[model samples]
Target chain A: MHFVDMLVHRWDLARALGRPYAAPDELTRVLNPCGGSAARLAPDDRLLPGDRPGRVTTPAIDDRDDRRGPRAEHGGPTALARRTGRKGSYPMWCSSVLRRPRRLFAVAVLAVAFPGLAACGSGSGGAASAAAPAYAPAATPTATSGAGAGGGTTPPSTPAPMPGMSGMATGAPGAGGATAAGKPVSATRVAIQNFAFSPATVTVKAGTTVTWTNQDSDPHTVTAKSGAGPDSPTLDQGATYQYTFTKAGQYAYLCTIHPFMLGTVVVTP
Target chain B: MSRRQLARHGAWFGAAVALSVVGGEVISSVVGGTTSAAAAADDTATLRFVQVSDSHLGFTGTANPDVTGSFAHAIDQVNALPYRPDFVMHTGDLTHLSTAAQFDQVKQMLGGVRAGSVHTVPGEHDAIHDHGRGYLSTFGAGSAGDGWYSFDLKGVHVLALVNTLSLEKLGHLGPDQLDFVRRDVAGLSSDTPILVFSHIPLFAMYPEWGWGTDDAAQALSHLRRFSSVTCLNGHVHQLFTKTEGTVTFHSATTTAYPLPRPGVGPAPTPQTLPAGRLRAALGIREVSHVQGQTTLAIKDSVLS
Candidate 1:
């Protein structure tokens, strides 16, 4: 699909610009998950009988029960991303996938029905983490405190969290213990500068409030990566958008206007 | 619905969620961007011009099977305007891949517009393999060193700048063009309403995506004394506006495909919205500055 082609293109650009990019581990995990997850298949993978010509399968949709909504947690690989043993971003991904009515039923079903397969995708996160240490949660906090116009907010002790890929494998040493206890950075301020969200990833305790201030001359947005997050109106210079995280999970976002300005919010319980 | 019927419904699916910012306040709306342009045109507006960007003429994506079709529809919107605009300015990206044929198709298609004159700048895509020799040769008449030039039109000075050539971290305006902007605006009075055009934004809209111009500040510094300045650009492929001092920056949407918002993803590629949402995401914008006004009144209407 075009998404795959785009992902490869992004890698090339990230390198060209000297920006850190996550290896396409989770993205290409299965290369073929059952039938409709991410990439369809490699040339060598055997095709399913129904996938062949003249099969005329009902539009690949599966209507799930209301109880198992698109946002419901499931163990599956197609999820946006999650560390091993952690809740995956699949639910949010499903919520966004449902935007297309024609494939809504099929993708919704894929999100909830295949959690068993989701387990396979998590193993790759741990391996990918070692490849990009610049994104580790520990080095996230920056020195400048982004407190409103009045000032007096101290920056977090940890370095600034990496931007771009928010899906680091924070699993405990033995793995499967996603309680990595992300360094709690009380300074919940993110500044938009040079077209990037400074401290691309932020860690906070559940129920904490975070604010994004735009320092760039042009407009930027704080939109959920899954199209399900509380999107902000376009913000110009000196404009700020605020949101409070009420749950513990990995919530990813990007500016709908400049999809390349990606950021993530990791909340710990 | 059948695939054909779903596509029929998809044509009307672009329900544009929009917002209007006046003087520093935000007003939001989620109307289906299907309203006609004539329905929003104003007769007494002081100055008027139609802004068209990202008309990727040769694009063949499922996002909208018929990019040329939608572009033609946009032309119809411009022709149907109740009052003829002083001039129609295409910010940039006229062709998807910068092909001679694509450029010709765009020129042939735009020839049908009812506006007084057609002016343009090059987008990175327009200069693809040919490096813009094709673009300048076709529409480069009267342009400066590159495809950047300025003209006085109906009391307004319009500058068409080409920043797509030799782009670095962001679109670049080398020393020559920056000097051109300096000398171009030096002769004009402080009261002239200035309209500057280019394919990429002159401001740092989102430098991460190369949406901003690297040395645009140097170009803008020359016009600080002007009472009104409107800078229009395409490339990010969306509608955004901002004002700083005497300058107002407007990033226009595309007549071809929509790209994700800044930081919404890893790249600014064509976005394929779910069916029934394409129209809301695609369309054209109309801008006008009244005689004594300091700001331009911009109206963005989506293709129904």
Candidate 2:
């Protein structure tokens, strides 16, 4: 009950400040202000976040037969994400250069793929010169000797914690102790990190006990969507919750604290 | 503006309305006098009010470590508005935990705001374990049936609804409130511009997160006849606008921490933005209705 109240109070403060409430319940969701539109979904529903139900219906304003209507389609954040591919909002020139290339080949490819690298390059002349930097090593002799000495001695100390790099490497399922024959192990671990369930979909044998460990600082809970499934209390950072799949069926679960973090356990008999 | 002149500015008016949907970008959109009849109707709209929501007082988290401080800033923002607002409506969630102390603290803080009167509708948070006994005692004055009431401000009829109580999956406005809505607006003419306030969205903004009111369809049925109906709510603390025929729904932002853009993250958890971006996500909304214009100007200003 206290948790629920915490959600509602989001607006009271944000409303007073005229700002976005940071409560889990009060994200800045913009829906059509007018009530009972067949098309409008809750601001959160607009985003196809994992298993959440609700189709993305364009806001009614977008249905208007006006040139301005097209822009309204991008009003919601999900729409904005879809429009920009979740990439940084770049100027038209950069986007145009990137869009024209079908496959990244060479000079044009390098320039379009890494716009930042070609920031100084401008127009057709710049595009041609942009390739020169890539081909020409342009190594100073003094720097080369220092690099030769360091390359052998300094074991690449700058491998500074790449959390995302490790996360991506382990994103594929079966990374959690699968047998060589691809058979599910009796016990496996699922890491909850980066607000996502690593190996979001797992295939496990019946009676397999799946243990979930929270790696992120935020708390999370494993709750079933329906039927009897894994239900765990709030798992704080470094906490572990184990649920044994006794029956053979597909069990879908999510972090109740973070519903978009969906996971599935395929329990095969 | 004359109809011909208004037509000349048609593109500009269209742009203004389009900007409103993006939340806080467009300040106002004047419906040009396409029909002299709409233009001539006595627009009893000389009213301006500020809406503050989701303060989540007593909350302490990285999303917003200083909710009270930010809420105080929100109060300051409201007081700093050029014109003294006639009333300030806090849609709901006055506190993070529905403790007696939290209620008293919010009441005192609200008292300091310079407005004619402060009004509020109970958010789900306001009705915790005791089922709103604490909230009602603190903020429920002259309200009917679990803190729902209506009053005429200027020419507009304003209805404060209670939809947070008895919520199943979505915010629920049981039969009593539904009946109240039907009877409340039955006497008013179809032209009366109505403003409906509730903590949860009276529309189906998102049922999965309980962001919407389940039975709001029935409540809204009673309002379809009105020429202009604007429903303002503050759950899903963000600015959103939707127009369904005569009815328009606007979801305001919060004074607390900002939540993720619907489903951008794993949950609607409070977002901990980079050090300087939290202010951009928090804001207050000012709504103005002119004496003779059908459109109401809603402006959302983020906390500086």
Candidate 3:
């Protein structure tokens, strides 16, 4: 169930970002919570009232100040509010409060009594009241705004930090843990410079997290064309991306932004 | 007795004594000197030649930035020898990317050698880029169409094989070149000494890495009748010597870089050595073949 929710979330993120939805098999493999902390939410589960079929409309989120577009808005309640517009303000507040330990206790009792009512009157009560004026006729007590309200608005000016979403900083395993898992086993150092990865072939252990540090003055990405582990993120210059493979395979990767910069990581078990 | 008679008697006695002394000296010299002179002759005829292979000059990388310098150092070692070598033979890969500049540099550096002559064969690296055009342009004529040529010197027939060009399925001498070698050696007596040279090993050193020639057996068949056949090759930049029947295969070191030992790792490619140890890793060889000898004496030395 949680796996499906993660997949749905990922699919929504992909769609919002104007990317093709990951195939079902790819989603099943990548978003599998076999070893992760995120509990798998089944496709039928009603953890979020908005997930119920026909019970809730698509929430319209607005981002009026983001320069890169609406997809650039990161995880945060404010960004979620902006994405779903005024009508979604209450649901966004409820999700934030549900994520909090203190408010989760209060909402737990409320959740059992009235499953649909839990979406309203949670955190950020100020924004919820102010956004009530924008609610349209179709807006039921549960209905949220659709994609049209803030579709063309400028993205949010401020980036929001998602409470439970692991940001890039904490996305990678700890350095000591990564090292203990056999990082840099090849004793070979490959430097990515001038938008090109040096020593195109790098051999490492299966559990080793090969860190591709962007040394180019411009922003670049290290996207794997093959054998990339789940949660592998693109990195910018001066930023680093690490992938830890649990199984031995040759991971052929190239910068998605710069297809010419090709490289391969040979993971040995 | 007259003074003359006394002097004569004394002179006769002195002459007898002087003759005894002279005879003793001659006998001692004959008895003691033979072994020393024989040893000295053996030492004097101990011909040594440096076999530097796969110089691959004009390569610029951390693997081997100063390939030319390392090669020149090998030459310097050859020049600084107490007994200057008769000649030097580079098996192949005299250039890295096989550029004209690389060949020119190699030619100029090799020209500085005081040896009698320097023989060469083409390596895969030499032919891969230009299909051996630049190499042929620089070192063609005397070499046959594909650079397979043989010459006799100091009682040894040195056959430079062009296996790189006429490479078989697994790097071998094509039937045509094999026939050429057969015809080249058919006239020579069976007792004649033979030294075969090629870029890739005539024996199977490492087939997976393309180290061995496919039809080396066919090429070796022609020289089986010879008293001594020494096969020397240089594709892998390390020294490995193996003997099969009358043939001895010796792979020479590269002046440019080192490669992982066969089967030591997943694949074999030129490895970048530490900045300081690059010179010591490059080596040279000396080969001396005596007439009527079954074994060719070889001495290996590094540039450092």
Candidate 4:
């Protein structure tokens, strides 16, 4: 775990000092699966041992698996991102590294050269990409296109994936063809800042997905005060969590991390 | 060296260190060294106590999926100590969301801890929604207004303060609390040892994150005459130490998740650490107050 911490710390330090950083080849090879198989990349989501800091045991990712894994026809940011489809394992590997212009090329080249591989890998990529899957894949048919759209424009400073709700919807209009009639669900955004939710009360349509973006640096969660309201994961600064209100009622919610941060979401028929 | 300079220099001593005031100047040295303060005390006479902070019970996040389990581990660690501590001071943030159920669960869990007694101050989380009325009902039995009170334990004056309430930009100690501090320590002699406990750090460790108290200086001024004053706090979810004049502040680590260091990120968000490292980041502190030493011997131990 120290290895990942050291790696993330190095990236954080480099970013803080305005320096460019790339992971060592050992971490890349050990963590990044050339096959791009989400199942093979599953172990990467768990904590790793720092016992062998400089040496990471390589996983078996070969060209033979290319036939078994997802398609790898085109290799640039768009193609690789489209593979983010149902499983978000690939973008999880890129994380902060995805923002660097050249790493995209490196990942693209990696994808083409290794036909089996669909995404690049780095330290705890799943942590950042976990926030992406919520809005990206469900709204789009390809499911994975959110990675390319959200990751491409995200700055290294904003390690969390850009709100896929905005970036992905526009970036991949073709992918949204399946749900074109009902696809473009305009989400009502609630700002969480200064330890309180802005506009404390929000009224939206029944099917509207109310997204809470934490503008505050401190962590916050949108939880139901009574019955079912908005149950969200911990939202860090620049990180977002959305809940679609399917029924019409007065749903009261508050930041579970800071219960005093109260807000109400009224859904109308 | 002048008294101010001596206290400032004494702060530099690392762990297992001892410090004392002599001729109006503080002197410090590594413990067990032939230092005047360490040599003068009898180890058996030391008053040993434990400090556990930010348990954040009922919290479940990626950083720590089982906060209740981890807090239980911390209490077990305290109980497994070779010697049961005189008392346990939980600096604050006992629950993630200050629900009555969370309070009850934490209270029952704390009851399992083997200590002389368990005391606490309120963290902002503890005052959630109701301004600490819920917390006061559960833990504020003998505490004064807003759960601030002081008591004498084995010749050491211990003050449990409430600075997490009515916070604006920083932790605030309103006039009522400040007055309590003045009156509490008014009769104590200059040589009496003083220990102040609060959830937010009294010193401006990082005001931008609301880590410091706005009116702590006033409270400190009332205790400045004492030969030794130590302030312990537990909000930032990380270990930090600062020394000013005669008082040294120590911020304890949480039994819950870890937060980013001051200015390390956009906000003091709980860091989602890689696996198997969460326990290393969460732990407890044991403080030993020796008879002759003005400063307590502080030792931080991580949960195994």
Candidate 5:
């Protein structure tokens, strides 16, 4: 229950920041705004990151034209990733935040579900051990809490960390187990098509070569969002940007031109 | 949402439906300009041409690292078409970063088009830091003020206007060109099928991203009287369309890099989608029309 609660809060923060909030719920997806004239697929119907190579001719159906004519027979990837539905309105955020009953209901539900969870952690031997799990959800935002996560040593008899704690966290999946730059990836391929990247997330063993080819007519870059990844050359159509991930760590990246389009590469030891 | 990005776009969506497709404000009345009618289309188009916009030559970026390759592909698509167009029209942005060498490369590349002639309108990129003096020297043949011109072929009136030459907050055509539009079409018959071309959109697409032209209302007002008018433009880097009465506006996609849909991002920056998805975002658009057929005038707008 506590883990579930923590996941919800992290999901909330991710959604609020307009970041990728892959809580794995299949029902939610921001509607794609490309002016295509066709019915859209339900969110659950979208393929997951490692799902089968998905392809569908763009339903470039012209809504204004009454006759269902033959479509444009062009080949390209499906630009299916969508922004969250929260369309950048501060007032809307304020309103959603101000709704108090939802909070009360959440508390009521948590109380009913785990009745006396206040008793669960107090029985635990030390605070540090219980708090170690907190690092996964709220590590980046709160400096003090994150620093506390550095050591597993617990002062015996300290009470367990309380639930419902709030702080910023950066729990990049497949993160932080590096053996210093491994080797050039053994010819991995990432295709750039339909204004999107295929296999938005990739997990590869160390010592593999990753090649990014821009199949779109647009130019894009494979830029590391943080330390420990190679910056790619601006790739044109049929141009490939190669980067050898030498270390075992999760690397978050985005197209510098289109920052909203994001991807992550996980190098496993 | 970065706090700053959210705050900035929040203001736009607050007063308007930022996410609304073709928001209500886009529909409208006339601005100030002479309203003269144009001739209607004939049973068949006597002449056919292809419009290429935003080739953005010399651009080097991750969004589309190989700009020339795509431009060449577009040219190749044109060359390989079954029916030869009477001419090819390049809307603008013949060069990215507006270098002399870039312009020369584009000119050399464009010289390979199979059309009888190539007509051009300067995009802001072509005007470069020198304010269009370079563009005027290269492609400004028979053009009037700031590289805006008009010519007649196949009984259709084609007007190429340069809105990128002198831009304000949005694109600006200036009073001179607005007046030119007034006088240029004044003598034409009411039934002529007028085709207007420009770089930046003459309509307000998204003011936050500077996708609109400030004085385009004046130019559009002059075109209002025309019975059948089609306005084709490029520069937002994606395809979109809006129709006002007899006048229909189509924004062409780029042959360089794809830009975000209007209001999807703060500005019209190039887009990078998930891996294996970029090809879906890029493709060549070819338009075919035959006389004696019910032509879907805005067919190319749906190519994406």
Candidate 6:
């Protein structure tokens, strides 16, 4: 079928399946671009095609000037039919068939297509297109409506790997074979020198472990104040210590040996 | 006139005149000697000195546990200086936990300094538990209300302001104290140097942490008429200095412990350092003011 015909057919199917259709006025504007009115759609309107004769009718046009009427039938549909030389009889057989099963069939079609049209209008299709697997609800007959409906956009279940990843990326490998969130965790090597910790402030996610290496000749202890209790063992020169911060806050620390040396760590969840 | 009458009258007049001349000579001699002695004392200039603050003794926390040791060490260092300071001034925070025992320990230790008498002010910690009762009992004899006092050293007019009491969000110099300062320096000439010492930083270093003094501007405003004013403070455990017009504000580091750098975290408080590095963290600063020079040269040295 032509694209326009296919679109109209789909719209009709959606409406027939109990899907909400545009209002009558909107429908008329969409269907009849030349300005069809609601009165034209009434059951007794005679402008309907032959198979559905008298689908619409107006009393003013049909029975105007009744006193002078019937003297000469020259201005009405009857006159027009005579002029055209077509039969005056209605198509009784077609109307009879349309009266019973046709209405039931239209209702059934609308009932089947209503949910699909509603889902499409709600932008669930866009969500499905972005991360199909992540957003895919469950295995069900209705789930098929999600596929190809969102134009292949789907949310990613796992973050994409990138070069120069700092092991901070979720699911990326870190130093010492630790992975962020279940992947290989990456290592972050921080050095303490000149009585000061390099990168005095560091930001990391919860469960990410930070390792401190003492490069200074003297020994230093990583002491957090009493309330800020996630602490590390005192690391001597050429020695290393590590701690995993489970909670998030500003952890201000200094070398127990060198009180002047100070650093901070910020953990974000 | 008869010879006898003339001779008697002349003798009486001559004796009276002679008495007047003797009285004049005696008065001149006494006044001249007093003026000469005062000039001699003035020629031997009085010593001017700087005030160090917040040396909290017996603070065993990491910020600086060996606070007393460092302070004693600082005293020894000061004593060993090439030129003996006229005297030393300790603005306040003389002890970490202001116990009678701590105050006693500070007195004994500071007594060993051969330089001169040490002037003291109260710190929040020193006054927190005792409400300054013990501080006053130990050091209050010559001091004014709540240990606020002033004295003259050399040519400088030194004022020790008590801010620990009436401590607001920042330090406070209440109306009474301000009025005292106004009257205290009212008679001094503009050329006379002035030094104001308090426990908290007079300028707004970091008000959220109570590192600054409120109403310092009022005290400072009173001092603006003077040609030279130096304001020294200690609280943040670090060194910071600023000069506004004729007033120079200096924040001295704590002899007890080092605090977190300002605004580096949610709030700033004393941080614990390793026992071995405590001495390195604590230090003393010396400020020398030459009379003719506009600037005071400051030297900070760590306690080895």
Per-prediction TM-score to the true structure, in the order listed: 0.48, 0.52, 0.45, 0.51, 0.47, 0.44
How big is the positional error of residue A104 in model 3, measured in Å on the Cα after superposition?
69
User: What digit string (tens of lDDT, one per residue) describes model 2 on residues A30-133?
Assistant: 22122211121122322222111222222221211211221222232222221222211111212433211121112221322222223333454344223222
Q: Which residue ranges in model 2 land beyond 4 Å of their true spot?
A: A1-67, A70-269, B1-45, B279-304
Arrange candidates by lDDT, highest first: which order? 4, 2, 1, 5, 3, 6
Docking quality level of the chain pair in candidate 2:
incorrect
lDDT of 4 by residue, B130-177 (tens): 779989999999999999988876677789999886765468889999
Best by lDDT: 4
Query: What DockQ, on C-alphas, does every prediction get?
Result: 0.03, 0.03, 0.01, 0.03, 0.02, 0.01
**Candidate of highest TM-score:** 2
What is the C-alpha lDDT profile of model 3 across B118-231, one tens digit per residue? 778888667742458888888876877677888876566779987776442246677888898989999998866677889887865544345667677777878878856778
**Candidate 3, residues A120-216: lDDT per residue as tens digits?**
4334443432333222111111111111111211111101121221221212321222221112235234445543454456677777766666554
lDDT, each prediction: 0.54, 0.54, 0.49, 0.56, 0.51, 0.48
Model 5 chain B poorest 10 in a row by lDDT = B12-21
lDDT of 3: 0.49
Q: Candidate 6: how large is its RMSD?
A: 36.8
After the best TM-score superposition of candidate 1, give how far the Cα of residue B281 lies from its true spot, in angstroms. 6.4
lDDT of 5 by residue, A1-269 (tens): 45545544654455355454443322121111222222222222211111112221111323232122212121001111101111111111122331132332243223222222321332431232132211110101111111122112211111112121111111221212211122223225665543344445667888877777776555666778767785776666678877887789888776654333456678988
Model 5, which residues run further than 4 Å from truth?
A1-269, B1-45, B281-304
Candidate 1: list runs displaced more than 4 Å: A1-269, B1-45, B280-304
- RMSD (Cα, Å) of candidate 2? 20.3
The docking category that best describes candidate 1 is incorrect
Better of 4 and 6 by DockQ: 4
By TM-score: ranked, best first: 2, 4, 1, 5, 3, 6
lDDT of 5 by residue, B1-304 (tens): 2223323222110011000001111111000101110011322344556667788888776667777987887777667544466667888888875678888898999999897688889887786446698888888889998999999876778899998866543578889998999998999887777888898877655443456676776887897777667788888775555444455566766778777654332225566556555644443222212233233322221111
Q: What is the DockQ of candidate 6?
A: 0.01
Separately for all candidates shown, the number of backbone clashes (residues 3 or more apart, or on different chains) is 32, 53, 31, 8, 61, 38
